[model samples]
Target: MAGAFEEETNLYNRIVLGSLLPEGAWEPLPHWLQGWLRNYIGGTLVYFISSFLWCFYIYYLKRNRYIPKDAIPTNKAMLLQIAVAMKAMPFYVVLPAISEYMVEQGWTKCFASIDDVGWPTYFRNLALYLTIVEFGIYWMHRELHDIKPLYKYLHATHHIYNKQNTLSPFAGLAFHPLDGIMQALPHVMALFLVRMHFRTHIALLFIEGIWTANIHDCIHGKLWPVMGAGYHTIHHTTYRHNYGHYTIWMDWMFGTLRDPEEDEAKKM
Candidate 1:
């Protein structure tokens, strides 16, 4: 584990930071600081690039088919969402940076390589890890809505985009900094409960950016069990259903799942 961590540090310094920073500039900082910088920069890039691509494809290219002309978020709303996300991004990346540092220090169940365990065991652990994260995030998110003070303060910033028309991909991360962190804490916490590939953990964290954007697009993909924009759109409007992340399993189990299909059927 120690050897792998050292190798990773060296690789990041040489390939990532080395290409971007002067030799003397970053060499003096500690390993954790370097990891944080890497996460911050990488996360910012993922947020912008993914958000723009999703927005462009949906809002520009296929706007007529995917989004309602009257329901489209105004430019001002998108800009505000972007601004809020930018302000919270540094803090949002901190959890992953800390998780990376902790994994390096051998404090987590994060394994340096999948070779340590066979493919079957690795996948089993991954399933367990995801399960823990799903359960934790569902409850955490539900409480953010159920608790009056949490909603009034931290979570309320995101509820501004409550209606379908006001929601867009940009609204994904447009959260109060602490609110975002609290929601993301489950991913990091899962590392302690089950073994996970270090690289997989990092990849999943970044995937959250894309997943959130997809959920906010307000286009129902009709992917069952998998929580698509259709389910999430209902969550935004009703506020009392579909609190599950990644999947509807938790919400279904907990009796909070609301099928978007049922709503459409009623309209018909």
Candidate 2:
């Protein structure tokens, strides 16, 4: 067991450090900038690539009529939302640094590699972490709405697109910095609760970033039991229902779930 662990650790070190830093690579960059590049550059790339792909998918879905397009935002509105998202970049960049700090402080358990734990355990941990995150965010999101001051000063910026088609993937992060941090607390919380592989941790962050945007794209469909864009679209429209992040379970349990299609059907 000890030998296997050491082998995995060596493999992870090789993959992460070997690829990130060639011999004397840091000599060219200042010490401060080295940390930024080492810790944040990959995350920034993930954000850019994920945001781009999500936007492209949104456009493709709309163009193909795979999704309805009633409340699509104007180019001006989209650009404004993109600008708002830019404000969140610094916050996003800092999160990984915080994670690294937690690991250094022995407050978080981050495995060196996935093979150190095997796929089944890794996936189980992933699902558990996601569930915990969803539960945390659900309550936090609800509180943001129920609390008058929080809603007005923080969350309201995100709710500007209060109807279908008024949102895009970029609008997902177009939030007040406080609002963005509050919503992101789940990721931080998960780090402490689970023994996550570093690679898995980064992958989940990538997924969370992309998924947050996907839910705002207004595509409107159920991705199995997971509530997709439709669930969130209603939240934007009504500002009261569907406060759960990924699943309707939390909303249903808390009696805040309001199915938009079902409600519309009832009117007829």
State TM-scores per candidate: 0.95, 0.81
RMSD of 1: 1.4
Please list the residue runs of candidate 2 whose C-alpha ends up more than 4 Å from where it truly belongs after superposition.
Answer: 1-44, 60-64, 67-70
How well is each residue in 1-268 modelled by candidate 1, as lDDT tens digits? Answer: 8569657756865677888777778778887788788778778888889889998898888877887788788889899999999999989988887887788788888887888997999999999999999999999999999999999999999998988878988999999999999999999999888988888888898999989999999999987789999999999999999999999999999999999999889989
For candidate 2, the 10 contiguous residues with the lowest summed lDDT are 1-10
RMSD list, candidates in order: 1.4, 4.2
- What lDDT does the true structure give each of the candidates? 0.88, 0.73
In lDDT terms, how accurate is model 1?
Answer: 0.88
TM-score of candidate 1 on Cα atoms, chains taken together: 0.95
- Model 2: lDDT equals 0.73
